[model samples]
Target: MSDGIDDAKRALRAELRERRQLLSDQARTTAEEGVHRQLDALLARTDVRSISCFLSTPTEPGTRSFVNAAIERGIRVLLPVTRIDGLLDWTVATPDGDVTDGLFGLPEPVGELLGPIAVNDVDLLVIPAAAVDHRGMRLGWGRGYFDKTLGSMERCPPVYAVIYDSELIDEVPRDVHDQPVSGVVTPTQTIVLSPQRH
Candidate 1:
């Protein structure tokens, strides 16, 4: 039933995408502000000096605001730059850092290109997700970038997936290659999940 699972994931992702796109500007702004506050609080509770975060797309849960805030707070925030080889290169986020469209049209921060291994040194990893299950399985946007990164890390730190509050559901379609997150940061709350990773 792998095909069944894949089909379900695709269908769910499409619906989630449409739902996010339909959000009003005001509603989106409020959600973004909530996300920023939650992320700030997560940092306050942890010793996350260096972090790896994604530059959010328009319809995604806004991490750009949190990235900027982290920079202002003097926390080292690394943003992912997509690589054609299915690995990720990273760059340090700067105040007002310019971003350009990279592979898959994802907005990647423009700065000194650090290699894929750079993420290994981070205290925490804040990644993008379409949705995360209560058990912490992350349904990404049809890309295995984060899964590959997480699976390869030697001493992986706490990895958190950022999603909207409504996206936290009881269950999501999962596959053998799927990776489970340590927690999820939503617009409303930061829910720590327990799932043993392979």
Candidate 2:
């Protein structure tokens, strides 16, 4: 059973990667606007005081607009930094700041390392994913970064995945170590999963 699940996951990931690569510049721009609108609505609905998100890379969904909006609202924003042990460390983000290259070429906050905060302290976690399902299962980039980080937390915050609307599907293959998400924000909609499962 586990082997079958693993194979399905691998196949789905490959498909998602191919689809992501096919996105044209015009499509990407349109998708970005849609994502921004959905995210703004989600933010308005919640009373969250602080958020932890990532710095975007070219291949990843860009987060500049979301980060800027959070900063403008005076919401404390945190970005993930990779630890030497292949884990993630959270630090607050600064306006127009520089970041050093971290694991998998992801950027990390460079100035004044704020150490790390307990995961429970974060009100919302904006997670990146290759794809996510309506049931809250997320398929990551296969590095196990967020999985390990989420597993290590004693008390977890609400995890919200950001993806293109087309990437949201009926289901995703899961593993024992996989952590379910609380919600997902796509270009078209904000999907809130049932709280009982997570």
- Top candidate, metric lDDT: 1
* Candidate 1 structure lDDT: 0.91
TM-scores of the candidates in the order shown? 0.97, 0.90
At residue 89, give the lDDT of candidate 1: 90
Off by over 4 Å in 2: 195-198
Which regions of candidate 1 fall more than 4 Å away from where they truly are? none
Instruction: Kindly list the per-residue Cα lDDT of model 1 for residues 39-138, writing each as its tens digit.
Output: 9999999967999999988888888888988999999999999888999999999987999999888788899998999999999999999999989999
lDDT of each: 0.91, 0.79
lDDT of 2 by residue, 19-134 (tens): 88888888777777777787777778888888888887665666767787888889888888877776777777778777778866767777555555544577888889988887
The window of 10 residues in a row where model 1 has the poorest summed lDDT is 189-198
Query: How many steric overlaps are in each model, in order?
Result: 0, 0
